[model samples]
Target: MSRLTDLIAQAKERDLELGRELEREFKVLSARRSFGLNFERHRPENVELPGRPLRKGDKVRVLPPRGSTTKGDQRLWKVLRIESENGMRLARLELIGVADPESASVAVDDLVVVAEFRDYIYPGLVSTGKVERGGDKPFHTVINGENFYALEALTYTHRGRIDAIYIDPPYNSGASDWKYNNNYVGEDDLYRHSKWLAFMERRLLVARQLLKPSGALIVTIDEHEVRRLGLLLEQTLEGFTIQQVTIVINPKGVTQGYLSRVEEYAFFCFGPECKIYPGDDDLLTSKDSTTSDDGYSRPRWKGLLRSGDEAERKDREQMFYPIWINPKTKRILKAGKYLPLGEEPDFNVKDEEGNVAVWPVRKDLTLGRWGIGVYTFNDLVKKGYVSLGAYDKKRKSWGLSYLSEQLRKEIDEGTLVVLGRDPNTGVADVVYEGAATRKVRTVWHRTSHDAGAYGTDLVGKLLGNGRAFPFPKSLYAVEDALRIIIRGKPDAVVLDFFSGSGTTAHAVMRLNRQDGGRRQSICVTNNEVRSSEQYALKAENLRPGDEEWERHGICEYITKPRIAAAITGRTPDDQVIDGDYKFTDTFPIADGFEENAEFFTLTYETPVSVSHNRAFARIAPLLWMRAGSKGRRIETLPDEGWEVVDTYGLLVNLDKSAAFCQAVGSNGTIGIVYIVTDDDRRFQSVVRHLPDAVEPVRLYESYLNNFRFSMGR
Candidate 1:
């Protein structure tokens, strides 16, 4: 009867009556409950600390008044979401306005985390060393979540580090598949397409950063989201070229056809220099082959070629111009038998006055560009090649192989080759048709993925506790795409913020193990569950302990755990996971950045601020090279601009990390160590790594003297 009871019934199909009775007795009776408000833009009112930067998994106090700097213990709030623009980052917090808790969809400016996750804490703690090492394969992991914000945070926080990304983001199929905060987005909803498009737009904009230039991204989307996703990738990867593709998941659509319809669509977003998987070339057995009379091998071409129009096929009798006679027709043909070139008996030659005349006969003739293959008159031919045909004594002729030699000798000796063969056999240099006309279409070709039961397993295995997330994905399907894109690339990271059941993680690990490589993957996804509209907390609840909550943390539960478990079976004691995985959700992050990415300023924007704990720290060290430096910095050093920032080096606002050495400068060459937060220790380290930076500078107390050694003020 009730929604909660219905969910219980759905979870336990056979015991529906029992579930309904249990739910009736235990279900909360409060009727005033609803999903959280999904806000598109940030509101000004419901925020307290307007400048505090929000990172992943932060629980900040909410619903406070705008100006009140609530000092005591009341400023506690949960950072439900995070967003970024060209550079400015914002935090989406659930604020309970002092006057009314209903107006809680306000956003505030985020403050940079001087210290985030300093202590490595995870529910499932696995000692990797404790687990026996069978093979040094790529560790697999899975993270599950219920919403997009959580997915974005896990993936965005560590962008460049990811190797390959695969995700089955919401289909937005005008069905319940599209849920913003908690409300179900129907498939036929008028704004379904628009809502889905907007949702994907933000995710892709951030997802692009996670890819290494050579890294590949495979997105599984239905026909509805296919076109919009194409545009989204183009907008995000500005200079990059996107190779659009159509994976016919099903020929069968809502409407039926003469044939069985089967095919789904998938898109691979990559930089200009991306590679596709070549598949198992060794497994390609050329069943069909051709050979000359003397046993020389001839090229065999397969597949349907529909070069002729309907008119040509309609008049079939016209093409039957009588077969050329062969004296050795009765002779036993070679295993790889091929017919010799026939004379030009069928072609009509135009005379001087345009009078039609029989074409001249050549013992050996080719169709040239107009026809498909060569046909030679047999009177002068030899075993497999076209010989003198009783015309010349020292003549040698094969097919293409002979043609190549003749052309080479003719070009070198400056001799005109007219002895039954012309040096310039082709009228034009270009040959063949379109570049990709050779490969067949993707109709029946099943990529080892989509066809298997893996997708079904994905849904049934993890989220089958209640309402199963339907048709998650087969690991092979995404893996096939990965193999197509990145062959044997050893150094590539993967990302997928919309991970459904961690197929991408499985693909990455499987591929690396297959190729003995070391490719990594990063996935992001939200926890999904069916709940009733009784309480706001109940509608969108995510906290510690629940398996659903852990599963929603895909990096911890799904991606990483799966990988670790495959290496070491199931965790026994710890509640982190049931499988034996020496799983620790702790990833490496220090106060300083790796300085791996080269930074450049496109506009005369405010530069990054640098501070240090040691003396002699300055802003100039980010750009210029210095001795005794292991770290490096990259920044666009502007000579002049509208507003001056740090002049010594380019200044960049701190985004993810707490502290790092950087050369900060803005237009007009004004530079200084921009202190994002007042943490002097982090600021001190920023000064110490100056030697590691491409540029090095000594910090002074002021424009005057008193320089500190690797220290900043």
Candidate 2:
């Protein structure tokens, strides 16, 4: 050990960089086993763009011929020229950055254009189309692109503004559902675990910056990666509080060796200001448990008379008060102030309606204190939070009850229904239509959460194809998960990067319908074609970017159509959808939600294009999102000097600053002012003169600097 230390010290003195490397290697060699996460962090993941055609001077990669091998060459080739020979199209290619470069000729169809993760690409969006319900409701956006790049772009527009994020990333259970470095990782793959961690870590780091201070992030996974994912979240989201909940998605269970797996896990990471809200059900009862006679679960009221330790009136003088009740109706009218310790009680006091006074007394006839103080009881009486209990034969007086804080909140949020006045109490007779709410439990078992019956089957019905996509989340499950954190925020902004089949967006729409909320969801997914579909398309000589092949991509094939069907209450074939949404709220599917949605494909642009103001058409939607995504978007440069719309304003000509400011001030609803100019001094001067409420942004320059800083352009 002494000799080893001496050698290490000498190596460090000789060369600091090499010494650190040697020390690291020594630690690995001497350890019993490596711990924590370890992987090739810099290994670039490559994706092929079949939509981009091969052209001379464009970089390309040679793809293996069909039925050859699963492994393909990772080497990148540069296209030198394109030529036709013997009725065949061929391209000359050169290996880039080689000292003695080698050149070869390959058929155009044999190569695919690649986007390497190591290089930075300017990102933009192109609107494909939209579904409008004709209202001022914010549009739920679905972007088709690699999630990492989409998240990077969102950081500029939605940073620190999202209220909640729910994602269902691939489980990496040695299935074909997930990919690493553009290849599916089989069960036998040696580094699959490490690759999964690295892939998740990169995206999560960027996602962490998109949350508001009060926002929460919910990630659902199966047993295959739950433990590893939990550890990764701990390291990545250091200060946030993390909790895990187990949900039974398959009650029958799938057999695995000794035990049958029936449940998955959802990890909830709550920010400092985040909290779990109440659900319709107590979330604790067994699926088969019986409810009340009305098919509802009602709150069990507690007596208002103090009992047990410190129950005497002398214990708390302030709690010793008289509750006036109408003798005829048994209705609680008001609460009288507390009696002094030396004062004698008056049981004969009556209100103008011949109401009698009631004192808190024990069964033994000893004086007791009220459960709540006089002021609290008085306020609760007005809000119907107080209740009257049945007559007690032993005490010869009617008892009183009150609601807990959790139950009161349920009444306020409309989760509990109020059925006029109770004949006995005259207070609002509120009852929960399902199970009474309680603190969210760690274990959840509901028939609606079953993946097969609700998830796979429901999605099949919507898409009209049983296998359009696999393993979509149960609609009710997603809604319940989101409701726990965002129940109070009616106009929240929710995002899901791994938006499979657009489940998160559909769930958000359902939530909005349930409560009349205007919450908007931003879903991002890739347009990668399924492996089986790719093989079939390739057999027909169809490439990825071809119209027919592109239509089969996940976004176009499943997500877009599913969302449209859900919003329009009709299937892609123009027939009304069958069935109804169950659990929490039930309504016919044909009565589609009154909502608006838009689809966009992520596009790449040159920084030069954005800086020269040539890409305003592409960048306009993003600005609308940044300005709260309300009203109509300014899609083109105004022919007039300036333009002011519902939520934002734009000044195309600096000569119209005064008019623009006047219009902005007069409108009073605009919150963002985009001034198009390259001059910093002039922009600052105008900003100071504008209204104090609006935020000023320098166009082109501000847009260029954002990506340049984040993407290192």
**Which number leads on TM-score?**
2
After superposition, candidate 2 runs with Cα above 4 Å error: 1-39, 53-58, 63-73, 79-93, 96-100, 104-111, 286-437, 465-467, 710-713
Error of 1 at 487 (Å): 1.9
Candidate models: Cα lDDT each = 0.38, 0.82
- Model 1: how far residue 639 lies from native, Å: 45
Candidate 2, residues 675-707: lDDT per residue as tens digits? 999999989988987989999999878777777
What is candidate 1's local distance difference test score? 0.38
lDDT of 1 by residue, 396-428 (tens): 111111223333343344321232332322111
What lDDT is reached at residue 428 by model 1?
Answer: 17
lDDT of 2 at 351: 63
